[model samples]
Target: MDILDQLGAVREGKLSRRKFTKGLLAAGVAMTTVPLPARRAMASEGEQATYFTWGGYDIPELFGPYQEQNGTLPNFAIFGGSEEALTKMRGGFVVDVSHPCNQSMPRWVQTGLFQPIDTARVANWGDVIPELVDLPGNGAEAGKVWMAPFDWGQTSITYRTDLVELEGEESWDILWDPRYAGRLGSLASGGDAWWCGAIKAGIDFANIDTPEAFDKIAAVMREQRPLMRLYTDDTTTLEQALSAGEMVASMTWNSSAVLLQAEGIPVKFARPKEGALTWVCGVMIHKDAPNLDRAYDVIDSLLSVETGHFMINDWGYGHSNSKAFDQFEEETLAGLGLSKNPVEILNAGHFQQPQTQEWETQMNELFEQIKAGF
Candidate 1:
């Protein structure tokens, strides 16, 4: 069966969990695999900006204004994780605009691969939520914005509510609970899992660079290693596993829960007592963009309320534009666990911060060793 049919069968309970997972593997869905939506070719006839971004963002719904103006979508390339995207750019894969979260902006800036954005050129700059725009390292001292903050979301525990039981308040400790060992999963990206691990270990995110804090977080992750049935950056695979009953719980973004619920899966995105891991991600212009004007157009279109509507309504993420929240009712926003007040949501969780390159290198290497059972 094709992917959509397989998804339908899993959602309708027509396919067993094990069979569903096997089907996905047979269909070539695995770790670090970008979704099929991102594999399409760039428009050959137009002078378009090359956009490097995550899978779902490549869809035309997010760039309607640009398409309406140019009559074609931007040239799209995708990465499963931020570190991989950065590595490619560092190795000279030039793209007009690339997406990276707040945590990685410092390193991206350090690489000298991106130039500051001229906010005047972006039509929606004035409408963007300030908290997202003013993130550390996002703007230079002279007030040149480095990234155009467009999307915000959370990384939290997404569990099969029908299968997982809670003792008290929900917490990250559930991932380490012996009862669920061998049925748990996590994202393979250290950018996410490591920060989540720090929260679970009771280490302050700001102090994660300290040796004492590092040791504590390392211990928690090492304990979690054997318990995980799989570690992948593929959100589709993670959602499929949860839907199939192959995984009772996994560390995932808000989009996973949204997607599963739409498919009739009994999943819940936990607002852990320790707080969820929240983030803001946006687009930055390449230092040597071939299509600079089109690149600005792409950023402006993405930050528009039309794209914001698609982001919140379709993908369950918060848009950086204040006008976007105006489109939703209070009850609807609350149900989706979002608010027009970005500060409330941002303060409700452990917001990721930019880490030093040395610390990031050490953390990723250690996490990989642990995952490999070394």
Candidate 2:
């Protein structure tokens, strides 16, 4: 069965381990062998702490207030990839918090790099959505929140609706359509590209371990690459391409679509048939994080409803705080694709976990091969 059908079964209470195992295995999940991180604490606040996160995530607008409250500002560093974050952490970067996705949580935990969170210290902890706060691997009691969800969004097909009208809606298969040869855009990075490729290959992305599955993904991407105008990591470029009619559609973050729509770009962010490749960025405290208390203050600040509003309205990503939705007008909610009932969206969304180093290595190697025209 296809991914959508499998999701349907899951939603209907019919998806079972027997049916989902191969897909899970392909996704490289070894249930029995799941690794957890070791516990350790870095020096206290007298020493400085560095934070490694996405570029925008640590902006002064976001962290300044926390600094004012905590009396110490965290030194910041930026990374484009989770692999880069992991690499630095392993190499003794004393980050107070490292923004990693849920998928990367397991790998970081297994590496003994994280200092578990003290939920009690975070006053707004109760405000976080229950499922989101207490997901399968969060390990709240162990003082390691693994990662705290800061923002969430779907990976969808961003297309100029004025340019093309499909019968039903945009689907992942469109990326593979020969009809649109030489007119597509794709990500040059590993995570987004692999997730996008897996969906188009018709192998459940959650199950991608087999050589056949990897080959299936590679074959489709090879075909799509010829059609792609260029593989890029910058969303700014994707937006420019769409606006100039250089490319009509591309896979991109929901925020990009929201921004374009606000500018009257006539873009449609379609939730593909295979389900959107959903991702959430979280704050993972480094095991040796200095200024531990201050780091907690930063986490609390980010979790505040006020911050959530800024994240949702200004940043264009869904906040981890459920309360943030209450602030949005009904029409506004619909425009951001948050109008769908929460449960429905969550059930349909494909959450990514941090991949193991082995998988990361394979992905990097495979991605390189694809880029080199192999």
Candidate 3:
């Protein structure tokens, strides 16, 4: 069968994931042998904007309105991490829009690669959470917004309710509990894992760069190492492990719990007594974006209540648009462990703050060493 047929079979469960991947590899090799113009022509099919973002976000569900209006999904370029995306952009890779979180907004603004977004162009501007839009460095001047906040959520322990028992109110300390040692997982990115460690260590994130805080956080992470089964940023991998009962618990995003619950996996996303690590992520227009108008359309679509409903109801994240919360009932919000007002949920957690480049580098390096059991 052809690549499309093979892909269909994979989706329909007629083909194993291994075989489908092999088919894709073979198809990619065959495509490389095609003429350059043919390859370029193939890539140009209904392409409106080029979206640079994390892997899972390239899906059509987040931009349904854009697809319906434009008759195509934006071309996507996936990045494993924000730093990788920035490095590529600096290396001259041009994309109409890029996604980054509040913590990285300051650094991204300093790069001067993004321009201020005209909120007047975004139809859903007034409906968006003001706190998210007013994130540090998200605006160049009074009233000129930069990024259009799209998604907000927490990173916390997701445990198998059937396999694990709580000794007290849910907390980050569970990852260090010896009872589940060797059955736990964590995100590989220090950007996330390090902050979670700080929460567990009782370190103030605003003062996280201090020697005392660094040392204390490092100790907490080192203690967690031996207890972990793996360290990875791939949410699918962690969710699969949880589904197969291979892992009792792991550090994961809100989406993991949503996905697992849909599949009838007995998972619970912890609301740690110390507080969860929360973040607001959004899209920014590249300074030299070729499809500027299309970029605005994409942002507006993302901010729509339709997209917001998908983000909250399907992905277990808080949509930036306040009107999105109106679609759900109080009981449903409570079941998902979310608040009707995004600000209340954001305030309840240890919201991530911008960190200095030096501090980020140091924390990443230290976390890497600890993960290596050093």
Per-prediction TM-score: 0.89, 0.80, 0.88
Question: Could you tell me the lDDT of residue 76 within candidate 1?
Answer: 80
RMSD of each: 5.4, 14.8, 5.9
Give the worst 10-residue stretch by lDDT in candidate 3.
Answer: 34-43
In the range 277-344, model 1's lDDT, one tens digit per residue, is 99999999999999999999999999999999978886689999999999999899887889998888
For model 3, residues 286-332, the per-residue Cα lDDT tens digits are 99998888898899989999989988887789888989999999889
Model 1 spans > 4 angstroms off: 1-39
- Candidate 2, run of 10 with poorest lDDT: 34-43
lDDT of each: 0.85, 0.69, 0.81
State the displacement of the C-alpha of residue 210, model 3, in Å, after optimal TM-score superposition. 0.8
| lDDT (10s digit) by residue, model 2, range 1-374 | 76556555544434432234334334434323432121122224345456777644544445545756755445667787788778877887777777887667777788888878877788778878766766657775656477787777777788877776576766887666666666778767777888777877777655776788788988887777777786776665576577666787888887667666655678888878778887766788877777787778778777878888876775467777777778989788766776424545556767665556798789878887888788
Worst 10 residues of 1 by lDDT: 31-40
Task: Let me know the TM-score candidate 3 reaches against the reference structure.
Answer: 0.88
Which candidate gets the maximum lDDT versus the true structure?
A: 1
